[model samples]
Structure formats: structure tokens, C-alpha cells
Target: MENQVAAASGKLGVLVPGMGAVATTFIAGVEATKKGLAKPIGALTQMSNIRLGKRTENRYPKIKDFVPLASLEQIVFGGWDVYNENVYQAATNAKVLQQTQLDAIKAELEAITPMPAVFDREYVKNLDGQHIKAKDTKWNWALALMEDIKNFKEKNNCERLVMVWCASTEKYIETTDIHETIEAFEAAMQADDDRIAPSMIYAYAAIKMGVPFANGAPNLSCDIPALVDLAKELGVAIAGKDFKTGQTLMKTIVAPGLAARALGVNGWFSSNILGNRDGLVLDDPDNFKTKEVSKLSVLEEIFQPEDNPDLYGELYHKVRINYYPPHGDNKESWDNIDIFGWMGYPMQIKINFLCRDSILAAPIVLDLALFMDLAQRANMSGIQEWLSFYFKSPQTAEGLKPEHDIFKQLIKLQNTLRHMMGEDLITHLGLDYYQDLVESL
Candidate 1:
């Protein structure tokens, strides 16, 4: 397909729906990175290298150098929040960074304030935000969000904009008749249907405005058929259901390693305790259900019991998230994985990871925003399956099962980038290189 969108240049505004911990950390990290305060360590597009062609070719280039992505300096950050705090205050409240680190970018951080959020008390029962839209109907609230987007774009002088949902997960909502079609969804919004969550309103506004949208939380933001169809129709890139960070990130990494070794996992019990606003929100079972679905899917897709029944068919995977106020945003996860080896000898691998929730999520937010913008510029619409590497439960095209194996997901992501820039997809088939030598001899 011929590329139709203009080349990505000038400033790209990253409009976040939630400007709490992850959002602030992301913006601060970018500012810190720009001022040489910190390096973008986990960002693949910024730090990782891609191997092109045969191993003998010795062609390894940084991924950014290969693709036409927006520079970190060129990325402008703005977003909505339930709290009216600026990025600096939000960062301080989050307590994810050291005082000295925050002080370094104090001025830049203080200047960015969150626009009033379009939030509802029902979806996230644990959170009560005084800073929210007061509109009566969902459609009116959505139009207000569109106005925010336009004003943000004009004020920031951005050539393009992308919205990433870094808000807390909403209550678990199954796809309903309201979510079945664009027309039904529009009518539902107009009628203020009780089933429709606040996040969907934000998503509707973004997709209608032709802005690329990515969901960082596990909320059903852009995942519904209505939004998916709208995205494709509008030709804007969309990705996610959740950000793949912390425990799930580790799960994708370790589960693949276990599968590669053909180890039999009898049970995997994972639990985490965090005290961030996200944790506070998820403390409610309804909200946690949303996160649970996104968290639990990795093992089923990764192990693929149909193919490796003996190794994975009996696997019992359980995930739990607790709200422990003492820990705050520093999420500590304990995973006890029960496995059996060659002779079916039972063994266990226990991991206790003490990770900062927002710190880990910050870079992911940056990568998604940049990559989603790149995907839009490259004219790749619909569900951005290539960016699946960054998501927890990647939204894919209907009828296609998502590839959950991290290595395969990585290859798909990298290959998509290569394909976009007219480069050959690396398949690890080096027969051609050896064939040349054999013929020459």
C-alpha cells in the first residue's frame, strides 16, 4: 500500500488522558533526558539496535537511526488529570523520583498543568476527582474533549497529536450492543448510557478528531469494535488495552524462556502490592477486574497448551494486586512459579521484584506515543499490531490471535519498522550468504 500521510516533522504533541504518576514521570524523564540529566534506558526506539540481513553482513544500526521517529526534543507533552496539579507537583505527589532529580527540571515541570479530566465516579469508585467535566451528556463531554485537543494542538503548535490513556483502569466492561457499531456507540453517548465508561468518551473524541490513540491502562478505551472501525475509517493508528510493564513485563520475558526450554509449569501465582493512585483505584474489585483480564491473558497465549499440553495444559495461573499504602508507587511483586523438569521432578522459581510502578511505565508511555505517531505518519491504521511489544493485551485485527511470545513480538515489531523503511525483513535464514561462498569455491 502506498503511504498517504505526510512525513513526520516538526513538533508532535503527546496528549495524555491521565497525568498522574506515569504521565508525570514520562514528561519529566523526557525533559531530564533532553537536558542530559538521565538516559532513556528502556526505550527500544531510542536505545536498542536492530540487526539487518545475514549475520555475516555485520549491519547493526540503532532503531531510531533506521526509522523516521520524532526526536525526544521535538516531543511536546500535555494531558488531562483528575487532580489539577502541574507535572512537578504530580511528580512530587507520586514520589517516584528523588528530590534532586525533580529539582533539576523544576521550571519545565511546573509549567505543564493538567487540563480538567472527564472522569466518572462510577467506573472508578475509589477515585473522587473535583477536577472533572460537568457536562450532562456523554456526547457533550466528548465534544469538550475534542475542543481540548484542538486548543492543545493550536497552543502547542504541534503538527500532529496522539492521546495515550495513562489513567487508572475502569470497571470491567464486556463488549455490549452499545459497543457493537459506530452508530450504536454514538447514540449511546448521546443518551448517556450507563454502560459506557469515561475512557470511551475520551477515545471517541480522539478517533473522531483523526488523532492517534493508545490505551495505557487496561480500560476498554480504543479496543471496542466501534472505536476500532472508526480508527481504520479515519486512518489513525491505535494500540493497546494496557501497558506491558512491571509484573506482566517480567511474565512475558520469563514465560517465553520457560517455554523455550520446554519446562512444565504446574502453577504460576503472581501478586503485587502498590500504593499509587492506580493502586488506590484498582483496590476496588470492579476496577481490578479490568486489570486482571489484561494481566491473566499473557500465560495462556504464551504457553499455548494445545501445542504443549504436557508442559502447559495443567498450568494454573493466578494474579493478584493489593493496595498497600506503605509501599506507595513502589510496587513489589512476588511470583512463585511451580514447574517440573525432564524426569517430572517438581521445582519452583520464586522471584520478588521491587520495582517502581511509574518509573517502569514512564519509558513505555514515551515509546508508545512516539511510535504511534510514527505509525500514523507511515499511514498504518487500524490496530497497530506491530506495536504489540509495548502492550499487555495487544488489540489485534479480528480473527488473528495475538502473538504473545516476546521474542516473536519483538521480531514482528522490528520487522514492521524495517518494512516501513523499505528494508528486508530478517528471518534468520542465512543460507544465501553460505550459498555465495559455496558457488565461489
Candidate 2:
């Protein structure tokens, strides 16, 4: 009883909406890996393995071997960016990787130039670029993007394509009346409503074209009911709202361990300093609110404060990000956690993480692009909560809370893969072998 998944053959084009540091870094890394210069370190689809049977059966296989995924050599890269620099120049400007490393694949990077991007200053107020689409109605811009998609697919000869939003966070936007249905959304686009952000326009174009779209920003880009419904109607797959990296990544990993141990958390104060374009975009209070909401939601869902009032109800969590040019793409984060145990005895946990922001996120871009393509081939569409392991605020079905624990997210991810291949699901409740102890006792 295997799921009917389409064959992963032919060239697969990975399209991105923004070709900034993160996007350029991801492109450069993939090119470097193809040339045998470096390994894709953080991507699970490339590096992780899956178990297919019971504990007694040694059937662990690399995920790429188990699942039909595109090979590194079979990938073709194309994207749009407000800054029209080629990937090589963009990667050099990013300063996330060394000049020597980039020079090794200079020709390959330089050959990939970004197409004009759809941007509005209102959504991201901190920066401006000359390489943007001409001012026009939102509906017109989306049509132009659809044309771009068609041209890219034909030029690359891609049998399949997926859109991963490696872009800046637009200002926080709530789902409004316009976002309730595809018809209302199209009307808003035609009317040039201010609420229709550029990211949504890209998403609409991709999903309407039956392409899978994965959002790596905190903006409610493709998470709205309208887009979710559109994805289902078009038989396209979509997943979104922020790549989980740095501080929030650590929080999801640690908070779950705390909850498992029943540790009573009082306060968790987290702060970050980064000098990338992301840090600057987030410096704007409006944009920061979007990122902050995504980061803060992890602890609450992981802790389940409402379910265990005494352990987590009084929790105080604050998150901050400051723009510091000196840090460049190397972001630093500090977390101060206060917990109580043994009749209210206080204990403190402190963590200082000096991490490269793009370095951690580049692999996420890779994994999502590959996984979203897999989802579409497997006939899965709409909100992809199983792919929630890579996001901070993953989109779920309406009225459903997102799962934020990294361990549980990993399990769900693995189980999804097993299910797709018709392998037995692993439940980790292997005490049946000990049944003889009950009779002996």
C-alpha cells in the first residue's frame, strides 16, 4: 500500500523571491557542494537517515536514498531580488563566506543573475533598491510574475519547480476580509489594496501556476486561508511563516527538554545582535513585531502553560534583536533562563551562541525546497505541518496549535517519510518483550 508519488526525474528549478545574503549563500553552497568543495551540513534531507522497521531489523537508510529527491547535480537555480546583483557579487557583498571560497565557483555564481523583484517600501522600510518592478497594480505584478515562472521553467527545462521565499520579513499583517477567499484576494489585488504584500503576490503567482511555495519569512505570506484554499484547489503544496534559526532554534530544542523533565520555568530573556540585511529590516519596529511574534510563540506552545499552570503559567518571555553592523552576518544570541525546583529553589541557565545567521539558514532553504517538491509529488497539498521542523511559526490547519518541540517535530517528520514509502511507523513503545516479567512477578 504505497502512496502514489510522482517520479523525481528531470531538472528541478529552485526559485526564490529574494536573492539576498541568505538566498545567495544557499545558492553558493549548493554550487560548491556540486563541485565537491563543501558539504551541505545542516540540511536533513541530505545528511539524515531513516529507520524502516523494528529495533531488531537494521534497516536504516539515508533519507535521499529512501525518498525520491532531486540530486545536487540535477538542480538549476533562479530567483528574483530587489538588488539585481548576480549570485557571485551578492555572495561577496554578503560576507558570510570567504572571498576565496566564492572565487572557486566564480563563473557559476556570476552566471546566475536575479530577475527584477516585486517590492514596496511600506512593507520593509529600512532599505531601498533600484532593481524592482515598475509601480503597477498588484494584480498586474502577479501576472508578470506568472510570466517569469513560465519563462524560467522553459529556459531551465525543469520538469518540476518549487518557490522558497528567501526574502525579508514584511510588516506584521493579520488575515483580513480580503484574505478570506481567493476571489476576495484577487479583488484586493486588482484594487491595489495596501494589505496585499509583495510576498503574497509571489505566492499567488506560484500556487496559481500549480507550483509548490515554501515561505521562509515571518510575514503571513502564504499562511492565510485564501492561499491555503488556493493551494488545495490547484493541487499545489505550501508551507510557511519563518525559518527557525539561532535563538529560536535553541529555545525549541531546550524548552522541550525542560517540559519533559517537568521543570518549572519562571523567566526566559533572549537578546540578539546581528549586522545583516535581516537585522536591519527587523530594526523597523513593524517588521520586528512580525519576527518577534514568531519567536515568542515557540516557548508558549512548547511549554503548554495553559495545561500546566503551576509549571509554566507565570512564565515571562522577552525577545529582542538589535542592529549592529560590526556583527555582519555573524549574529550573537544570549538567553537567560530562570527555573525552580525542589520546593521553589531557584536555578539559572545561561546560553551565549555566536552563530552565522545565513550559515544556519542556508540549509533550511535547501531542505524546504526539496521537501516541498516531495510533498507535491506525493499528492499532498495545503498547510504542510509535517514540514514544521524547519519553521518558527509553522502554518497549521485552522484552530489547530502548531507543534514546536524539536524532538517531536523530528519524529513527525520521520514518520511522514515512512508513511509515504509504506514503511511501518515507529511508536517507541517497545515494552511487549518484557511481558514475561509480569508473569514471573
Candidate 3:
């Protein structure tokens, strides 16, 4: 028997919590892709293919053709942002896309002005904006957001809605008693508890409305127990923690290979220079701590220090984000690795990756929104870990360590799609090949 999954029909509304550099880029890119003015260079939903059946089946198909995903042309974009500017204005300010590109879709981008956002100066200390909901209570603010969601869906004529948190990295906060239960969390919101964050408010509002939510930042947006339990209760699909772009994206890809080969590492130092809104938010020590934790967890999990203490237990991993205005969204990262091979001979690897931050991240936003919405349609709910391939610190069920190895995450993602489509899950066991060969002969 198969799970009762819904088909992807009708328009999908993609709501973003923070309509800044990354959100604007993604919005414009989607619009451009729809207009046939540009190709979706990095989006997997538009560009990736999936393997099915067996290695010999020759059954690979583009993921979009394999699954029932909403067409890009049918996607309508709306979002909330602290800045009152429309997406066009924000995109122009971002300077990521050129004027010629923005000019092609000017009207559409301008029409999608940002709704006033739920903002708190305390959670994001580095930046402040005038366009914000000033409700005294978090509960009231959440109520207001819920109203916004309802209006957006109706106005957009959307058959479904999904929210992606494209906001700044919130100041680090541990999960406390208030986050243990939805009841407690609602009480904390009603009480205006300082521990509750704006992202959490957005999450509460989205999941409560039965909308699928994907977190694109490193804050504990939907990762808290309150939201997770509520998602399960509400039967909504959710994924989160951070969009794995730039350096961490590279780390997840390369670190797993080293561990696979049983390589020894003494130290791995990573640092980045970026000037996007995200970089500025992360420049704050408190905000950076949250990003630091997310970026630092990958190697430890990939290397499994508990399993190979000698190789990684003393692994001195340090990550830094420097705010440099000149770089803008063009983030340049540097990594220095100290490794030992065969009888403890020391070798060093230095990598300097000059990457466009939002360029890489915008596609991640698209893939997550599409896949999370697909999960909801597939009757999947709560902590979609198979979607972990797109995140830096993936949210897992309680007592579960997130998989950070990029290749493994891809296999899980592909297998989930296969399972959803009633195809056999690939296990890479090929004893059947011999039997099939004899039969064919």
C-alpha cells in the first residue's frame, strides 16, 4: 500500500519572511525564468534529474517530470520584510542582478511589495527598519501575520501556500522550558516572553495555518519542539535551520569524502568575507554564534569524532564571517586544512572560493520551497529530514544527529522521491544484476 499523496495542481503561493537580498534575488530569478529571459542556472527543481529503478534500468528522468511539482509560471510570490520597499526596489538595491535583467520584469517585481514584517530589535541587533508590525504582544503579532497569510492566499488565488524563512540569522538562544510544548510557547508569546523570536512567531503563524514552512536561516525557527509538535499535530511538512550555501556547502561536499577515505585531520579553519544583509547580521558576535554553531556542526557529524576520535576528536574547527561592504553578495571564503597521512606525514590544503552568496542561495530557496510543498502534498509532515541536502544544520527528530555529508543527503532526497512515486528505493545492492543477465541471455 502507498501513502495517499495529493497531486500538485493549481497555483502555489511562496511566502518569504525576510524580503532582502536573497529573497529579492530568488523572486526576480523565478520571474525571469518564467518570462524566458534567463535560465534557472542553479535551481535543482528546474535543472536536476533523478535516477530510478536500477543502474541498468536507464530510467533516469528530470525531477520535475518525475514528480508533480507546481510549474514556475504558476508560482506567485509575496513576503514580509522590515524594509518597506517592493521587491524591485530591493533587488535594485541588492545590486546582485544587473539593471538590464531587472528591467525585463520590472512591473511584476514592483507589484509584489513587501508586507510589514514582524521585527524585534533584540533578536536581530545589527539592523533596524521602519516597516514593522508594532503589536505589543507576540500573540497579537502572530494573529496579524495569520491574517496576512489568509489575505495573501485569497488575493493570489493560490490553491496552496508555503513559507520560506529568508530572514537574517537571529541571535542565539537555547531551547528552554517555554519551547517544550505548543501550550507553553503560546503562553510565552502571549506574555511577550523575550525568549520567543520573530522567526518563531512567523513559524507559529505559518504552521498553525497548515502551511508548509522551510527555514532558510540558522535560527531555531521551526526546529523547536513547540513548532515540531505543532507541525505533526497540524499535519504540515517542515524543513530548516540554514540554507547550505557558500563555504558550508563546500564543506559538506568535501568533508564527507575525507571521512569516507578515513583521512586524519588536525585542524580546519574557515573564514568568509561577505557584505550582504545576512553577512552584516552575522557580523554581530551574538548572531554569528548562531551561524557558527550551524557551520561548525557539519564536520563533527561527517567525521563522527566519537567513531574516529584520533582523526577528528581534537579537530580544531573555527569559522568566521567578516562584514566587508565592497564584496556585497559576492562572498569569498578561505579554508586552511592540516591533515596527516600514512605514518603521520603532515600535508596542508588551502582553498579560496570566491562565490556569489545569494546566487548560490537563491536556488536553494526555490528547491526547498518546491520540495517542502511537495512533501505536504505527499502527506508528509514534521521534520522532513530527507530534504536535509539543502541545509547546513538540518532539523531532525529528537535525539537524532543531522546528516551533513552532501552525497548521502542527495541519496536520501532521491530515495524519498522514489518512495513517493511508488518506485523501488535504490540500495546499491546488485545481486539481481547476475540473475537478470542470465535471463536476458
Candidate 4:
């Protein structure tokens, strides 16, 4: 494919739709990273290495060094929130970062006050805030979001901008007739159709404005056919459904490892406790369903029971999330995995991971924002399936099954970057190198 967008230079504005815990942690983390206070640890684009040749060649380079990603210093952060607090206050409320960390970047964090949110109580029933847009119709709300994007770009002198949803997951909305086509969606927006959720409006505004949109929450967002068509029409790259973090992250990592070994999993039970706005919002059954779908699909796709019936046909996977106030953004997950191996002997693996939800999510937000911006600059548009490593239920081009294996997803992601820069892909066929070694031996 011929490249269309220009190379990434100058400032890149990352406009988030929600300035809650995940969003604030992202902003703070970026600021800290720029100041050398913290490394972009979890961000694969920033911190990981890629092998560019056969294993024996030893030609591994940092992925960022290989690809032309936006530098941490050149990223500008802005967003909207249902609460009026700035990044500093939001981070404080999130309690994900320490007072010392917030104090260190106080000036930068406090300056990033959220623009009023385009919120709907109907979509997210658990959240209530006075800082939401008063305009009732979804169309007006969408227009306001577009204006916010334009103003943020102009104000920050950004050469490019991308919007990522870091907000609470809305109630589940299946693909209805209204979401079937861009025409019907736009008409629904005009008629103030009740079926159109708040996230879809933000997505429409982003795609209409030629900004790459990524959905971090599992709400319908840009996944529907209508938005997908609009994104392609506008020639913008879009990705997501949910950020793959915490327990789901573990499940994806472990499930594949087990499946690779041809182990039979009889049952897998996952339960988590978290105390954040996301947690509270997910306390509602409707919102949890949105999250549940995103979380549950990983095992099914990874195991591929149809292909490996003996190993995975009887797998029972259950996920539960509890709102425990004491945890407060610190999500703790316990997984009980029952497996049999080597003559059908049953074994169990119990993993208890105490993780910070927003902290885990924050770097993913950074990586997605920066990479999506890079994809735009590299002229790659429409459904960034290569970014599936960072998401739970990754959005893909129509008729394509989402790949769920973390390692394969990583290879796809890295290979896409290498391909973008005209580098050779590593296929792990190192016969020549090993052959020479054997002859010498």
C-alpha cells in the first residue's frame, strides 16, 4: 500500500473523551515519562524490542527505534470529563499515583482541565456529574465534541490529533438497523434516536473530523458497521473495543501458553475486586455485560474448541467483577484454572494478581494514541487490527476473525510496524544460520 499521510513531526495532540482515572493516569504518566521521572514501562511501542531477522542474527532493535513513533516529549494531552476537575485533581481522586508523583508534575497536570463531557445518564446509569453537556440530542453533543477536538488541536499547535475513549463503559447496544449504515446512523443522530449511545456520537464526531478514534471501553463505540464505513470514508485509522489489562491480560497470556502445550482446561474462574468509577459503573448489570462480552471472548478465540476439541471443548470460563471500595482503582483478580496434562492428570493453577487498573491501562492508552497517530502519519487507515495486542475485543475489518493469541498478535503488530518502514519481516525460519553452525560443528 502506498503511504498517504505525512511523517509524524511536531506536536501530536492526544484528546481523550473521558478524563477519569485511566485518562488522568495516562496524562500523568506521559508527563512523568517526559521528565524522565518514569519510564514508559508497559508501552510495547516505547519499551519493547523487535527481532528483525533470524534468531541467530541477533538483530533486535527497540520497536520505537525501528518505527517513526511520536516522541514522548512531542505528545500533548487534552480531554473531556463528566467531572470538572483537572488532571491533577482527577489523579488525586483516582489515588493511583502518590502525592509525591502528582506534586512533581503538579503544574503540567493541573493545567489540563477537561472540556465539558458529552455525557448521557441513560448510557452510564451509575455516573452523575454537573459538568456534562446540557444539550440533550446526540447530534448536538457530537458537534460539541468536534468543536472540542478542533479547539484542542489549534490551542496546542498540534500537527496531528487522535481521540481515545477512556471513559466508563456504557450499557451494551447490539448492532441494530440504526447502526447498520452511516446514513441510518446519521439520520438517527438527527432524529435524536434513543438507540444511539454517547460513545457512538464521539466516534462519529472523531471520524467526521478525520481524527483517528480508538475505543478503550467496551461500549459499542466505533465497532459498528456504520462507524467503520465512516472511518474508511474519511481515510482515518481506528481501533478498539476494550483495553486488555489486568485479569483479562493474564488470561490471554496464560490461556495461549496452555493451549500451545495441548493441555486440557476443564474450567477457568476469574473474579476481580476494584474500586473506581469504572468499577462502580460496572456494578450495574447492563454495564457489566458490556465489559463481560469483551472479557469473555479471549479464551474462546484463543482455544479454538472447534480445532482442538479434546483440549478445549469442555472449557468452562466464568468472569465476575465486584465493587470493593477499599480497593479503589487497585484491582485484584483471582483466577482458578483447572487443567489436565500428561495422561489426563488434573492440575490447578491459582493466580492472584493485585494490580492497579488505571495504571495498567494508562500506558496502553499512551501506546494506542501514539501508534494510531503514527498509523495515520504512515497512511494506514481503517481498522488497525495490528493493535489487537493492546485490546481485549479488538475491532477488525468486516469478515475477519479477531486473533487472540498474545504472541501472534505481538508479531502481527511488530511486523506491521516493520512493514510500514520498509523493513524485512522475521519468519523464525533460521535453517540457514543453524545449517552453517552444524556444518562448522
Candidate 5:
């Protein structure tokens, strides 16, 4: 099993669908890191270390060293955006990073321009741009996107390609009969069905081209049975529904602790204000519903209210996202958590998280891309539940619950890597040492 994965040999093309704040920040950050101007912080593949054996063996190594992951030097970035701005211009417009950092990698960022994108105004009502693909049926649009993928890979001399959807959330939609099978999906595309979103078309194109796809937004992009089955049939790796950043990231961390300590959560009121293109898209009630569902699912799964009814049965969870232009890419979130402990006495936990949206998401994009590629090389396909560590709504198979606890997610992720490398999976059950001590005594 250790020798099963192919080598990460040549240039890997990272094709993004929406080249806005999150996309631009990711590309620029990678460029800056490659130029030695910055480090790949918050990226587990680049920064975090994995423990291979027991606590005493001291076989700890960076995940990058432990796995055959593509390096920053091997990455070539390109993507499609509704906006025509190059990454440099987009990064400047984003206001996420300092202008000085953008200036440091100006030429590299400017050299990469967005290809025309597949856009549907009906899906994302709050945004419109002129750089959209020519008017065509959804099937034709997917064909055009496949052409884009081919041209990008050939032109960039990429040995492998992976698409990370860094796009805005579309209006809420559910899986209909058309989304039941690839044949139905293709027919719906030919018929130009309104239910087929731009992200789904992009996902179809990428997976059809044998490219691994990762969804970074809370859209039903590759989560439906159609794309999920297609990926497995084609032997391509796919994951996600939304990146677990900022507020949700904190919830996964804190909520797990509360559950572990058996503290009762009565209410959790969450609010956020952001002003990026994402915020703009999410301002629409229809589009916001998609995000709201993604954000709201975190607690129920983590808390398991039905299992512990007395602790969480009466829990109230509310989520709100306000688009404030002055905030730019800075997202400020507040969470008021009401809990109770001994004697059922109530207490409160107020959390205010002022975080850079793209800054947090950029690293997630990198990690997913690298991990998706790694999963491909390792011959893994379909929804990568292990990569759920990076997502808010982890796309699992139907009838399965997603793990929202960040700590458990990390352990699952690390253990997956260990399993990949033929190393012993660390269960953290130290009873073996105690057993040995008792035998010695």
C-alpha cells in the first residue's frame, strides 16, 4: 500500500472556477511562497507535522515529507472568473493582502489571466460580469469548459490537473431526478435545465477530463449522486461542499470540547458581516439559503442532540450573514452560546472572531488541491470523507453523517495519511504501555 501511489513528478495545474478574492489570494500566496517572500502557513500539507508511531519513537515528520504531494514549485495556477481581472488586479481589488505583498509577485500574478467563465445570473443574482462564456446550452457550456481544461493543461505543460471551486454560493437547490444519474444530468445539460448550476457544469467538465474536483463553496456542485457516481466510475477523487473557515472553524474546535465535557448547549446565535464578492452573492436571500443550510448543519451533527436530548434537545441555533462593504474581505463573526453544567445552571460563551476571509480560505484551497491530487495518485476516488477536515459540510455518501468535530477530523486525516504510508495508525490508546508495566511488575 505504501508503494501504491504514483509520484508527484511534474507541474500540477490548479484550475479554479471563480477567480475572485479567495482564488486570487490562493494563487498569489502560492506565488509569494515560491519566491521565498512568505511561508505556507495554515497549510497542513506544507506546515503541519504528523506523528508516525508511538509518542516515544519520535517519528514526527512534516506531512509534505511524509507523502508524495506536489510542491509549490510544481504548481501552475489558472482559472475562470466572471470578472476579467488578472490575479494581481483581482488581489488588489480584494483588499485581503497588503499591496506590498502583491507588488512582490506582480509579474507572476499578472501573467496569469482568467479564462471566460460559465455564469448563471439566476443562480447567483447579486453578481454579473462580462467575462462569461458565450450564450449556449448547458451541455455546450460544459464542452467549452472541457476545452478550457485541455488548453490550460497543454499550455501550462501540466502533468496533472485539479480544480478547486472557489466560487460564490448559488441559490439553494436540491437534487432532483435529473441529478440522479450522469445520463440524466447530461440530458438536462443538453436541454439547458435551469437547475444545473455553473459550478456543476464546471465539476462535470473537470471530472470528465479525469481531473480531481474539490468544491469550496456551499453549493451542490459535486455532492449530488450524478457527479459522485461519475467520479467513482472514472476513478477520480472528489470532495467538499464548503470550506470550514473562520466561524465554523471555531465552532468545530469549541463545540467538540463542550460535547466532550458533557456541557449542555441551549442556544447558539451566530452572526457574520463580510463584504467580498462572496458576501455580495450571499446577500441574496435565495443564495444565502444555501449558505445558511451549510452553516447550520455543523452543530446538530457535532452535538447529536437526539442522542443526548436533555443536554441539547431544546437547543436553538440561528445564523445570519450581513454584507457590509466597508468590511471588504475582513469577516467579523459573533457567536453567543448558552450552556449549562452542574445543577443545570446556565452560563454563556460569547465569541467574536475578526478574521480575514480569504486568508483563512486560501490555505484550505491549497490543502484540498494537494490532498485531492494525493488521493488521485493513491488510486482513491469518490467523496473523500477524510478531507472533511477542511469543509463545513463534508460530502459523505447518502445515509452517512459527516464528522464536524475538528479534532476527530484531524485524527481521521492523519490516520488516512498513516494508512497510505503503511505506518501504524495511532489510536492514542496507551493501555499497551500500562500492560507492559503490569507484566514487568
Candidate 6:
């Protein structure tokens, strides 16, 4: 069934929470793409292709062409940051992109500056920035953020806006009674209960303002019951928990292959070292626990030890992160996998990956913004499990399992797009064509 989707018109305001390495890199990359200085390499909205109809039809189209997504030229960038630097300055400090490329779009980046951010050091102990909103009750903080969103939309002449959390990871916190319902959550916010987090305030502000919210960190932003109910009630689309990049990205890609081959994984040890702000925040044990949980859960879901006990029942998983200032935004990871094959034959796979953190994450931020915007325009509300392809720990409905296999996630995403556009969903049943040919005889 084809659903009517609004045409992509006017400027889409892409508002990010933290204008740090990932956010700045994304903004700069978009500016560079507009100027023909660089390409949007990893963003599926810009670069990936979708297949429609039968294989014999040979119909393939770029995702941007198939779906009604905001064009790169039609996007406006603005966000909040604890640091008062403009996008250009923030990009330079990040060192993710070279100086020469930044020079080309320096003026455009400089034109965009971060507004005061709603920050609290208690949540992210490692970061304390001077450019923060006035210390106030949580309700007031949400209101202030909503005001910022309004002013930004009017000032920039944006037709629509979406918020993506590109900030540091907050310390781990479980859902409590305050997160059970909207009334309780708002009451806690008004009471300034410590249970509410700054990210939740941002989420509440965006959803209340009718702007779609996507979380790029492993924090409990819009994943709780209160916000899920709020999004559905307000008819806003929301997705995420963390952007899948670097080590976790590799894990999702590789683990599925092992499972498909029926390889028994006995143990998997994953370690990463990066000097970026993310690494620093994760250096704190509480914050690292949040990230650890996100990274570790990928395997269990993909392997399904409960279903395949002989193959994965004894699986042991360990994840570690180290903060090494010398590496800056360059993140290096090592994975040691212990697997057994037929007759319990033991084997091992070792992989050492040296990757740029923001470089890998920049496109994810861009894609989530555009896709989330499309979801909103299409009237798809609540948890967007179809956009799970870009997240590490995708937020799902209550008691639903998240699809961790990257290939499966991609199929779900593509099928959703097909379903949205009134096209036949491909099920890879090519034998049907042969059966028809034989029946004609």
C-alpha cells in the first residue's frame, strides 16, 4: 500500500545537541558536498541504492532518488554546544578534516554558531563547558530548549527541524518510576528530580515542539516509556540509542557472517582506544557501562544463544575502552574471536582496525537526520525500528527484539522505503520466476 508522503521542499533545519567532532564533521561535510569539495561517502541517503521489482527488471535507484528526502542544498545546519565555537572552529579543533578542505567552506561554517546548550556536569562528569543554559528546574530547561528551537526555526526560515544527539555519553542510569508515564515524567521535571537527565530535557523539548528526535549516543534519551508515549501522542518520529561506527559496526557486520556459517563463537574480546571526547567520557566507569552494554548486546541478539545453545551457549563477551589523548579522533580497535567449527574444532580470528572516529560517524549523523525527517513527513510516529541500520542499540517497541544483523536491518530499511512508495517488496524468491517458466510448458 502506497502512503502519501509530502514532497521535500524548502529548507530542513538539522539541529544537533553537541557541536563536537561528529556534529562539526557532518556540517562541514555537507558544506563541502554542496560546494563540490567533498562527497557524502558513507551516507546511505546520499550514496546508497535501492532495488525495486523483479531482478529481471533491473530497476535500481539511488535511495535519495527513490524516497522524498531533503536535498543537501536544501538543508540548514544549527545546533547547541557547550563550547561557543562556530562549526568551522569546532571542525578545526576536531582535526577530523584537513585544514585545506575546511578553508573552502570556512565562511559557511563560521556563519553557523552554537546556541547555549542545556548541560549538567553531573551526567557527564568529564565535560564542563561554560556555554550552558542557566541552572534551573528541569521543566524550565525543557522550555528554554523549546524556545531555542522556535527562535532557530523562525530566524533560519526552516520548513522543518530534526534533533540528533551528537553529544558525549552520559553516565549509566536505569529507568525509574519517574520514567513510567508522561504525567510522572513532567511532574519529575517540574520538581527538578535528579532522575531526569539533560538529554531527556532536549528530547522533551524537541518532541513537544513537533520536531523529530534521534539519539546518537548510548544514553537513555527518547528510549523510555514516557518519551515513547509522548512521541506517539504528539505524532513525532524517534529512533536510536547510539550511532553504529568503528568497532561495533565491525562486530555487527562480522558476527552475522559467523552465525550464517554456523560457526560457534566461544568468546569475543573487543577493545578500543580513542582520544576523542567520546573516549574521555567513556573513561568514566559509569559512562563506559552504558556504552559497554550497547556494544555487548549485538552478539547475543545475533547469535541467539538460547536458540543455538550448541553454537553459542557458552559464549563469553568482554568489551573495553581506553582513553589515550595522543591519538585524538583516531580510534583503534582490536577484536579477538574464539570460534569452534564442526566436531568442536577450535579456531580464532584476530582483527586490528585503525579508524577515524568522527569520520566514520559523520555520515551516520547526516543519514539519521534526513531519514528521520522523511519519517516525520510520512506520518510514521513513535519508535522507528526500521532505521535500525544506522544505530548500535536500536530502540524498539516494548518487549520487541532489535534486529542486530546488519544485512537484515538493511533489508528492513529498504523494504520500508519500498512499502512507503507503493512498490513490491523484494523477498529474494527468484525460484518463483523459474516456476512460472516451467508452468507455461
lDDT of 3 by residue, 392-428 (tens): 9999999999999889898999898889889999888
TM-score of 2: 0.98
lDDT of 5 by residue, 218-319 (tens): 999999999999999999999998999999999999999999999999999999999989899999999999999999999999999999999999999999
In lDDT terms, which candidate is top?
5
- Candidate 1 C-alpha lDDT tens digits along 118-180: 988999999887888785899899999999999999999999999999988999989999998
List per-prediction Cα lDDT, in the order shown.
0.90, 0.94, 0.92, 0.89, 0.95, 0.94
Ranking by TM-score: 5, 6, 2, 3, 1, 4
> How many residue pairs clash (N, CA or C atoms closer than 3 angstroms) in each of the candidate models, in the order given?
0, 0, 0, 0, 0, 0
The residue ranges of model 6 lying beyond 4 angstroms of the native Cα positions read 1-3
Lowest-sum lDDT 10-residue window in model 1:
1-10
Whole-model alpha-carbon lDDT for candidate 4: 0.89
Compare candidates 2 and 4 on TM-score and give the better one. 2
Q: Which residue pairs in candidate 3 have backbone atoms (N, alpha carbon, C) closer than 3 angstroms, thus clashing?
A: none
What is the alpha-carbon lDDT for the whole of candidate 6?
A: 0.94
Model 6, 187-246: lDDT tens digits are 999999998989999999999999999999989999999999999999999999899999
lDDT of 2 at 261: 89
After superposition on all CA atoms, what RMSD does each candidate show versus the true structure? 1.4, 1.3, 1.4, 1.7, 0.6, 0.8
lDDT by residue for model 4 (1-441), tens: 325436678898898988988998889988988888988789887888988766657888988887778888888888888899999998998898999999999999999898988888888999998898987678888888888888898999999889999988999879999999998998899899989998899899999999999999998888999999888888899999799999989988998899888899989999999988988999999999999999999999999988988888999999999999888988999999999999999999999999999889988998899889988887778999999999999888888899989889988987887687767776766687778989998
Residue-wise lDDT of candidate 2 within 309-381, one digit each (tens)?
9999999999999999999999999999999987888999999999999999999999999999999999998
Candidate 2 overall lDDT versus native: 0.94
Estimate the TM-score of every prediction: 0.97, 0.98, 0.98, 0.97, 0.99, 0.99
lDDT of 3: 0.92
